[model samples]
Target: MSIGQSVSKHRFACVTAVCAIAAACGSFALGVGRSIWFDEGYTLIVESQPFARMMDLLKVDVHPPLYYLLLRMWISVFGSDVMALRAMS
Candidate 1:
């Protein structure tokens, strides 16, 4: 409503955005290039397959297929590089 209030709100938003971006960057930097764990390794294997095959495998596997399906699409757009894959999270 008031000029001071608006400026304060804008400054708060900017600070929040900057903090969020910095946190994400720091998290990604720490995780990037790290060795894939068992679950992520499974994701890599499942996501690399054909859609139908991935689905079929999921039928017998314990985990759901939704994440793998999305990962498949992500890999299609971004390639299978480790950093790119981890960043997709």
Candidate 2:
């Protein structure tokens, strides 16, 4: 491409990368030290159960199962530490 177009493309990429980093840093900072509240505690409880049990609980509960399913997978990969769980969000 032309010089102007090339510069514009590079600038766009730089801006996008910077914004992504800023957002990630902000999210981690906000979430890292925070304690889990009642709803989050329920999520952790469900996540700790077996997959089938979690599914059963979801059936009676109003929330969807997909998040729990993904959280299960995340826990499998990352372990159930608070930091890991928070980072998954």
Candidate 3:
């Protein structure tokens, strides 16, 4: 292969690698920031409540009961780490 062709191939490879790395970085950043929201904090609090009593608290909350119910189920499937919990949200 000519030198020019080799150079072009190297440039393409570099661009592809950079794009992949950038996408991975962006996903990780979003994952890290996922736990930094008010609703997440509220979810954490509600999830800590006794299973039998959570329904009463949900009755008075601002959002729909469906979200709280889904969150409760999610927490059961995945243990309640803030990051893990937020990832499911």
Candidate 4:
């Protein structure tokens, strides 16, 4: 009820709001701007094939088929949305 108390409450509310906004923005930026590196690129390349082809390729390829198969299914469900792709990562 006092002026000083009101001012302190207002300042605290502003600081809390600003901090929440900043944390959200930072998470968004980190998720959106992150780049896929070599392993991710290779996963995409392998998973982009049809299942039969992917299986055949898996025979000769060195990496596990499970991850690539999961990626393929994920892409099938979500298409190429960057957020979905990043979530898979």
Q: What are the models' TM-scores?
A: 0.82, 0.88, 0.56, 0.53
Query: How much is 17 displaced in model 3, in angstroms?
Result: 17
In the predicted model 2, the residue pairs found to clash are none
Of candidate 3, the 10-residue stretch with the lowest lDDT total is 27-36
Residue-wise lDDT of candidate 3 within 12-86, one digit each (tens)? Answer: 999999999997777667877454578777788887888767777877887777877787788788877776675
Which digits, one per residue and each the tens of the lDDT, describe model 4 over residues 1-89?
Answer: 99999999999999999999997777667778667667667667777777798899899987778878788788889886566776676
Question: Over the stretch 25-88, how does candidate 1's per-residue lDDT look in tens digits?
Answer: 9988888668877877778888878878888889998877777878888888999877777877
Compute the lDDT of residue 69 as modeled in candidate 1.
Answer: 77
Candidate with best lDDT: 2
Residue 16, model 3, lDDT: 100
Candidate 2 local lDDT, 1-89, one digit each (tens): 89999999999999999999999899888877688767778889998897788788899988788888899899899988777787777
Cα RMSD of all models vs. native, in order, equals 1.7, 1.4, 6.9, 7.3
**Which whole-number lDDT from 0 to 100 does residue 85 have in model 3?**
72
**Stretches > 4 Å off in candidate 3:** 1-27, 33-36
Query: In candidate 2, which residue ranges exceed 4 Å CA deviation?
Result: none
Q: How accurate is candidate 4 locally (lDDT)?
A: 0.79
Best by TM-score: 2
Better of 2 and 3 by TM-score: 2
Clashing pairs in 3: none
Candidate 2 has a TM-score of: 0.88
lDDT of model 3 at position 87? 56
